[model samples]
Target: MAAQRTIDVRAVGHVAERIYIHDSYVVTFGPDATSTNLWTLSNDGRRLDHLKILRTLEEPGGIAPIVDTERKLVAITGRSSGPPELHISDISSGDLVRTLMLYGSLDDVRMPYSSRLGHALVSTRVVDELPRVLVVDVAGNGWIAGVAYIPPDLRTSTDDRPDPQFGAEHITDDGDIICSYVAPPLPDGVDHFTLIRWNGTPNENTLPAVRADLSISLVDGDAVSVSCCLPFCDDALLVSACEAVQDAIDTAYSRWSVLRAIGLRALDTLWTAEPVWGVIRRLHHAVDAGVVLATGTQNAREDGGKNIPVSFIAAFDDKTGALRRLERVNHIAQGVSVRLCAATSDTVIVIFANGDMSMASLDDFLAHGLARDVDTHKVATTQLWKDDGKKVVHAALASTSVIVATQTNLVVASW
Candidate 1:
């Protein structure tokens, strides 16, 4: 009924306030935390063995810790005060390998490590200036590539004040980087969002050239809520936008969220899917699989004018944008919001806002109604963290394990 392993981080000298898991290692850190507390959970999810605890930056910066599985490194950000710093450590030995102080603020969240080239990308800003993207060679311990929006000729101009912003979001498995640039507001109050790609290596000047760009207009006060690189397809991105529309009377506005699959090569819209009534809150890709799952809640008003929240799950084909499955979820009581959704190759993990978790079989859910004899095939679902009162702070679905961080304990559940 339960496949779970709970670790009392407090008893182990940690509050488990933050957790990052990748491949076979799980890292937990607090203000006074150590990397030596990282553990290797067995594949069966029944046990975990802690490695020698190596203390790291006790007061790391505001950036979230990142686990680079390919290079077997863990990158923790620097302190909040000074120029940003990146501390990289070996995952196996829990040893600090190198620390690189970057020219940026720790408040910036657009930092991602590229394992292919052993580089890290971060956005930096100066006083009253726009942000610039920089790439540092983690292995070489030097700045290798960078891109500046303010050209040399314009930097010295006194009258021309153009407000633009650029930052890197993700690095593809191949070494190419994906970035976003927000252009200045148009005279009509419209904004433009441009997605750029760093195709190849930088030139002799250490400047990266923009290989391709796709710009989308934000008219009528529309906003881009979320954007990220699509998994399994490096040449595509997933974007969610919220568009506000005026009613026929022109007195009020109503908003709707739209999800789009965009191709980078041709800068074209591959497909678009809009939820029936609500915004898409969580997006997760089943790694190495052709499925991406989206979960959200729909607010519908009844005849009595009472608003009710209904949670739903939607599965889409990663390549062709075909709708694979759409179902409404009611695992818990009414009015409970869905907190997070993570998918693996064959499992869909759902964590509710009330600290309840559920794991459903993806294969069984997709196989339903396919066989003639099995008229009503029900997907086998397993309830996790049953009756546990602790609040779920964060959760992740790795290869075969579900990592959940509660207020007092870190729970790992596997199939």
Candidate 2:
């Protein structure tokens, strides 16, 4: 194996919003942050610099910066305090010039994601109008969801044609809002997914806004995947999930004493949809070289608070539903364990509370080596994320000053 490279974090402050891949170093900025602070560094853990993301009113870190090579634009996937938002930067001048946002006021919230093609997609929870249905948009500002108001005088038929055939006021300049993509909302509560798209002109060779087709018809309940993200964008949209279903504890008893994981998978209806299940919690970063997933599973579980079991670690292939690797963590603090996916490789790094970040190749886990543990403790502050009944978790890569922001001081990262 190659010698372990060192990534000097030059700086770590308030909170991070997004990390933008720049020509020199990866530029990180904050969304709800106060000042426009940007952290810059090279991709190979070499050169680094820090600059002002925008002028003033730095929105902190609520967006991710993507390099639009074709458009020569440094596009930012940003969010705001009130409704969700998406901002694009004028790479020519390093300024946030364009914008996008969710239109309707759904009971819950919506999250923005992107395809490999640079086209962004967002999903939100819908209430009043429909239950168990998600509102969606692909073209962003070029779309809208509304009903054309028809006057009584225009009705000539006896029953006054109920809804207009072309009633759906859609595909404006905002974006294309597509419905009926996923199977349907689960019955009880088990995370399910769907796919939708916009044809630019509804009929043209523009581009296929293909979405991940997640179906939940078989599972008659509500279930969601939160805080987990796909490693990268392959032909198929593959995602990884980590649910520490139990809390950590320290006990003293010796009957040939050995602690184990006690995970409790819950099944509820009401609370399921309220929190929006199966949402991606975070995206540490994408790795293009690997197509596998690594996991650290807990044996013991939780009922109220989230759980973490320092017991086991495993790996799997996203293309084929096959277990690639698995290992048991020598119980450190009883029921507490976690695996952090590396940003460049398919390496699932382990972090313990004792503050040691170690890495083990998932490739070796498939051959023979046990889930080599990396004892690492995240240096971050715990903060409460206020989500609007939407089964959504913000993957905002909070940073100091790489791009301009609308607000600042987003929730601090716990891990």
Candidate 3:
């Protein structure tokens, strides 16, 4: 471990988007009280040599910044009084390259790491209008390639839609967009999940799409709610769902029958308790390691909602999904959200919203599980930074270093 380092971008607001880390520069988006700006800093978290104050009409924190190092391009989503707009700029010069006026109320946008192909998946919904996914080219040409209209019946009326509600999950190397769509609750029917593959082509009507239903029945006539679904690999999907009456978080592989389903609360007695079963907030797969990591607030109400403890669990298993090790990383305060959990070849890094971070050896977890709970700290160490009202909004892992973006500054920590 090394001494934590920080860089100050004075008066810059909290990071509301993803931070982009390239060879030697860290690019981020944020705003002050009056306007938004695109910032670039050295990779060591020491200097802010490049800054571009955006237009006065641009909305702050509207879209996460996406950088394409291969093309020296940066894409940002913002809005004025009209629909959302996508801005493309030169990463080195911070000069505006192009602006594409996306004509709907934007919900979300996903950009591929490399923009050499000039494509992005955009989701938007207007009042009394159908939600749609738009495939746009954010290069200087600004071409609208295709649109996928979300089935009207799939829109949930219960509350704010769970994410991936008609959003792109993954884009293949061959220009195919893999996305997820969840049908809303029906009169007497259970909600279903659909995984669609769209060929990136211009279409006046619905985009040429092929879809597969990923829903499964554990028992007859049981209603299940899909919490989230993401592309697991080139041919498989990872889905999380909860039965109508079951509180445990059930995670399964969409295409692999050999991989058995695992519950987040299955191995821990603390999580098996009544209310804690519903506490699993998010699930992420370490694709390189064939393991799953889940994070959430446990026993939230028991702590009177002020300082609840958030828990992290790493589940390691084989290709057949037999549980090998279920390790619960020590819980942290409720105010601290796990902003990001990323892994390298051998280390797993977890970043917290309150500026706390920890790293655990992936090899150790696979070898020991929780066999030596007391020695867990030896393999994993937690460090806390002084709270300054600036929360860490996003993080990225570059080799062994972790790049973190807070509301006012950028930090780089080495494991």
> For each candidate, what TM-score against the reference?
0.73, 0.50, 0.67
lDDT of 3 by residue, 54-123 (tens): 4433563344466676777777777778777887878667677888888867764344332556677777
What tens-digit string does per-residue lDDT give for candidate 1 at 297-353? 555433334445556667777766576887655433333555556566777667665
Which sections of candidate 3 miss by over 4 Å?
1-25, 31-57, 61-63, 109-116, 151-164, 186-189, 202-209, 216-309, 313-318, 321-325, 329-340, 352-355, 369-396, 405-408
Q: Backbone collision count in every prediction?
A: 3, 83, 2
Stronger candidate by TM-score (2 vs 3): 3
State how far residue 8 of model 3 sits from its true place (Å): 18
- Residue 82 in model 2: lDDT: 62
- The predicted structure with the larger lDDT, 2 or 3, is 3
The candidate scoring highest on TM-score is: 1
Model 2 misplaced regions, further than 4 Å: 1-32, 55-72, 75-84, 105-118, 125-234, 239-291, 294-299, 302-306, 309-313, 327-343, 351-355, 368-415
Predicted structure 1: lDDT: 0.56
Query: Candidate 3 has what TM-score?
Result: 0.67
For model 1, what is the alpha-carbon lDDT of residue 169?
64
Q: How well is each residue in 1-415 modelled by candidate 2, as lDDT tens digits? A: 4434332322233344444444443445544454444444444433344544553343533334445544545544343566545455554466766565553332222233233234443333323222122223332344322222212222223232221111111121234433222222223233443323343423222333543333233222332223233323322223332221122132110001111111111111111111111222333222453334333233333343343344344444433334454454544442333323232244444443322334444454456544332564322211122322311112222222111111232222211
